[model samples]
Target: MIPIALAPASPPERSAWRRHRFLLLRRSSQLAVLALFLLGPWAGLWWVKGNLASSLSFGVLPLTDPFVLAQSLAAQHWAEATALIGAALVLAFYGLLVGRAYCGWVCPVNAVTDAAGWLRRRFKLNAGSAPPRGLRYALLAAVLLAAAITGLPVWESVNPVTLTQRALIFGGSVAWAAVVAVFLFDLAVAPRGWCGHVCPMGAAYSLIGSKPLLRVSAAHRSRCNDCGDCYAVCPEPQILVAPLKGKAGSGPLIQARECSACGRCVDVCSTEVFQFTHRFDHRRD
Candidate 1:
């Protein structure tokens, strides 16, 4: 267990809880969202009527993945008014609250990749000659172009995120195989690589929620010990470098779209260097 920022006067149990607090909360959120989808089919409770890609809660609150919507639009597929509203709601939620948050909190594939990251850490492994970070953008462009060319939502037809969920619900062998391949790729080839480096959907989220209001700020940058633990734990380590220690423009609020706003940095920093703050609260000095 990493020793996060803890009050010296706090008791041991409290300290332990504090260290793992955000991580536990995140896991709970992830599982709860998954349960919501499962509840409809498993227990005959139609509270939500779809998977993460698209869902309507209580038969009213519609939510749709805007990236999927974008692909559909590119492929010249026209969605109804309700689906448009759902996409707008999703965009507003992610834009107002957190960017790329889906990657960290709601994506089921996140658990798979997180497990891979844990295994990599346990084995003391290092990524070797990984593809350029910009490959994701290229892939994003390629997917869009493919959609335009083929007049079909190509990625949606076979997206692992959706496939994994469908597999869990319907037991599709091909979907499970696709998911397992992703897990193995993350575990053996790259550490924190899929969402961090590739994933066109993540790129889309980052753009949609580019200047999200909820952000993880380096509020206590003065106390930083250069321990490198934050970098070690952060899925998007490059996003932290400028805010933590670099040129002045980026400020304490991590402005990069790639930031998932995952609290690992805050949870691991024993010196209390990192703290969550709004996008406007750039107290850099």
Candidate 2:
């Protein structure tokens, strides 16, 4: 067995790292808000003005642009098909290496919610709890089915990034305004509300997250005091907390399909209760 060691550091060093992590989270939240409120809308407007396909041009990630791939796949054009497949493989590889860090650190909607929740705390509004984990899968199925049948990328309509971009560029249409309002309310009132309960991309990640490779682990359970700080701070609390509390089964490392592996739990845990591990090790736990 590979031996594990504590992250070599004094308490002061560890504390400094914690502060840095929190700062990163806060800065990420700020950038997300800016992107959603400013750049996203501009991109959307450009797409609309040019009559360009949103996915093909204005999507959050270039790899996620479904229109080109969908068209290629639908047409069964070998050259386009090969290119699309290659791109997909690259994205999958990148995701495995990062472990959904994008969802926690970079997703615009998630940032909006984080900012909203920060504001709501002053009003004593509690962060809303996540809905049933199964809901995401159902939503994913519905979205894919609709996209397949209608040949319209339905994800664009509800996507927070796209909505934000549209709102920024169009100067607030009714639809864009609603999207912004919902995002603000959900972020402020609910932790990862958009991602935890609604994001179809999250559903896709959850399905494949449990591969035997590229997992996180809790290296020193004995250090745990059960203070629950990690649980309290976890953005994807349902996934991280319930399992550690022994209230849920361990299959998917985190139960919520929405977990973005942002390392918030690791940052908050006073006991150093968690770390990245392989799936084989995660199952053994």
Candidate 3:
């Protein structure tokens, strides 16, 4: 269990807003993306159409979730031309720029899980033993294998991300149930379990952007005071160790694909030890 004392204490030298700037920005981004989809149904503004499985922006630009496209192909279904184009667009953007950034910035479900994590930490709740991190990769493979055998995008049936968005927009009982299950699982069964150790969608994104150029860097690792604030807040804290400690000459850049490029570490660090940077930046002070 994480102690409440590990929560970030705003250093007198840093304003509270400054300390939480990235966190605020991430929240705003997540809400803005959701608003784009909600606007069509809520207010009849069709700037973006369709769900995360496939979307059209302004009736021109197409964006498809590549993992879903892979499932279609694995099920022996020929993808539409638009789907191919959309998948390519998503792959290029995530593969070259920000790895798994979707998990941090755009995924609506992240907010739900983040809330559960906060409540767990706030109450000093003891989480059940966490499943192996590697379980996610195996689940990713299993999702694909299931798709092949079942001839369906099976994961979508119970995917909390999609269900959470649906519950907010459509208000279905099953959708709300799935969302609650994810929240309860994280709050009681595991801390940050759904995304960090079990989500195949996250696993797919990690592989898609395995070598992304954009990364978080421990540029000022020398200033870190072992305050534990960053680790307490980060969703995938394991990725921070080597870079923050300079272990085995790991350099300053956080190169782990599992890292969602979430800037919680940068936001919570009183010493300002972390920053967003390109992976090529190796400078340390």
Q: After superposition on all CA atoms, what RMSD does each candidate show versus the true structure?
A: 5.1, 8.0, 5.6
Candidate 1: segments with Cα more than 4 A from true spot: 1-14
Instruction: Rank candidates by TM-score, best first.
Output: 3, 1, 2
lDDT of candidate 3 over 96-197, digit per residue (tens): 999899999988888888899899889999858678999999998999999999999899898888898899899999999999998898999988898999
- The regions of model 2 sitting more than 4 angstroms off are 1-16, 22-62, 65-79, 120-123, 127-130, 165-179, 187-191, 241-258, 277-285
Candidate 2 lDDT tens digits, 1-285: 999987745333366666357548656664754554444445644321221122223433323333333433344443344346545753575345545555565555555666665565456567567566668778767776676677665665666566665555565676577667766657554555666666666665656453425554554554667777666556566566544644444442453435566676677676566765554554423
Query: How many clashing residue pairs are found in candidate 3?
Result: 0
The segments of candidate 3 whose C-alpha lies over 4 angstroms from its true place after superposition are: 1-12
Per-model TM values vs. the true structure = 0.91, 0.65, 0.95
Q: How many Å off is the CA of 59 in candidate 3?
A: 1.0
By TM-score, how accurate is candidate 3? 0.95
**Any idea what lDDT model 3 has?**
0.91
- lDDT-based ranking: 3, 1, 2
Residue 59 miss distance in model 2 (angstroms): 17
TM-score of 1: 0.91
Best-fitting candidate, measured by TM-score?
3
Q: For candidate 1, what is the lDDT?
A: 0.84
Clashing pairs in 3: none
